[model samples]
Target: MAGHRNIGSAQSQSFSKAERLNSKKLMDELFNKGSSFVLYPFRVYWMKHEQPVPSKVQVLISVPKKNFPLAVDRNRIKRLMREAYRKNKFLIIDSMNGNEKNLAVAFLFTGKNLSPQNLTPNPSLKQRGMATQKKSSVKNLPQYKLVEEKMIEALNQLSKNSLK
Candidate 1:
């Protein structure tokens, strides 16, 4: 958490446990074929299907290089996203605990570059026709605010739904 933003409150720190999923088979089983829950910019796809004691949550954060060519930018965004999730995912954990449900979550980055300055249909298009055009990379894409809001909303809804 060095050089990370500490914006959330203490109540958002309940999810402190970190469990590792070492086996590729396990990861595939959980993430590859699992029920998905979509919030918005963040998609939570998980299931109650795992071996051994189901007391832990395995998570993965993704930042598509196709969307963000710069590895530095992608890594930075992923770090921020993970930090945000680590700070906020406690709500979902508590709700899941209360509901007695085991889960596996993956935080995927589906953000696209839609800046007004670079409003082209293709961000990776190098040539338009015969002349050869310059392909402008993704510039000034939308921030992850909506992703955070949608995560909160998803957690809140998960809490509500757990009551039933």
Candidate 2:
């Protein structure tokens, strides 16, 4: 992690336990005192940690039980969300390191469950001439990509307003 990172590459990506936010007290405070924003499928909530650390960030990802009644459905969604974050977090980590702050964030999946139609590539993707015809990994669905894009956008916005 000390050296340069390759953007958009999944080879070295990881979401280790150290980077997971699990404190009930911290989570409670984040909801009570943190700022929040809706990034479509996800509702993001974040707050700066009192003691800043070099790691830069710790995050919690959740899929609501209401939307996904079955445990398997919720687990699948959470897995995809976590994978997307693991691949996309370098953008935020570098920016946050520059600002020297530790941030705790929660991403709650709020969108309705993906129906059969939703699993198919978007019409806009087809219109844009993206290759939707070829078989792709089940993990490469458009919704998950959208989640990554929205997360990056939120991280950029957060970097601009980071604790100074």
Candidate 3:
């Protein structure tokens, strides 16, 4: 009998190491000189990487220490942001792919600090949905469709700026 192996869907959905913005100099430029747009809770900073790179885009997500005094809250917000970006990044990546350019981007979570109750799990959630996790709920996430739309708008803005 032939062996059955599990499909590597996690790898396909994962944010690989190569797609992370880890360079010090690049990050400095991305913050100091990059263009930004605010979509309520998410502030996106993005710039075309000056140096050539194989990856279409690299992303960094941050939830400020000032806003989230507890590490758990900060980490949870970051996890949600990453989940949103990983699932929706194709909107930007598809555009960049056609033009063959590399982009470095940072997404900062700017939402107000919530009371612990606001971050608690909702018992009614289904197991696997874009906006919820199995153990904990990503409460207060902008709807997945809205997040994707915002990403697309930001990328469109980036392209327009590039033309000028």
TM-score of each: 0.63, 0.71, 0.67
Question: Where's the lowest-lDDT run of ten residues in candidate 2?
Answer: 133-142
122-156 per-residue lDDT for model 3 (tens digits):
44554455344332334443344554555556656
- Per-residue lDDT tens digits for candidate 1, residues 80-111, read 67666666776666666544455666667776
Arrange candidates by TM-score, highest first: which order? 2, 3, 1
Candidate 1: stretches off by over 4 Å: 1-17, 20-22, 53-55, 99-101, 114-138, 141-144, 157-164
| Candidate with maximal TM-score | 2
Instruction: Please give the CA lDDT of all the candidate structures.
Output: 0.59, 0.71, 0.67
- Model 2: number of clashes? 0
Rank list by lDDT: 2, 3, 1
Candidate 2 lDDT score at position 90: 73
| lDDT score, candidate 3 | 0.67
Question: What are the per-model C-alpha RMSD values against the true structure?
Answer: 6.9, 8.7, 9.1
Query: What tens digits encode model 2's per-residue C-alpha lDDT throughout 1-110?
Result: 77564774343477888788887888898899998888677788988876643356889999887766657657877887888788778776766755545788898988
> How many angstroms is residue 150 displaced in model 2 relative to the true structure, after the best TM-score fit?
3.2
Candidate 3 segments exceeding 4 Å error:
1-11, 113-164
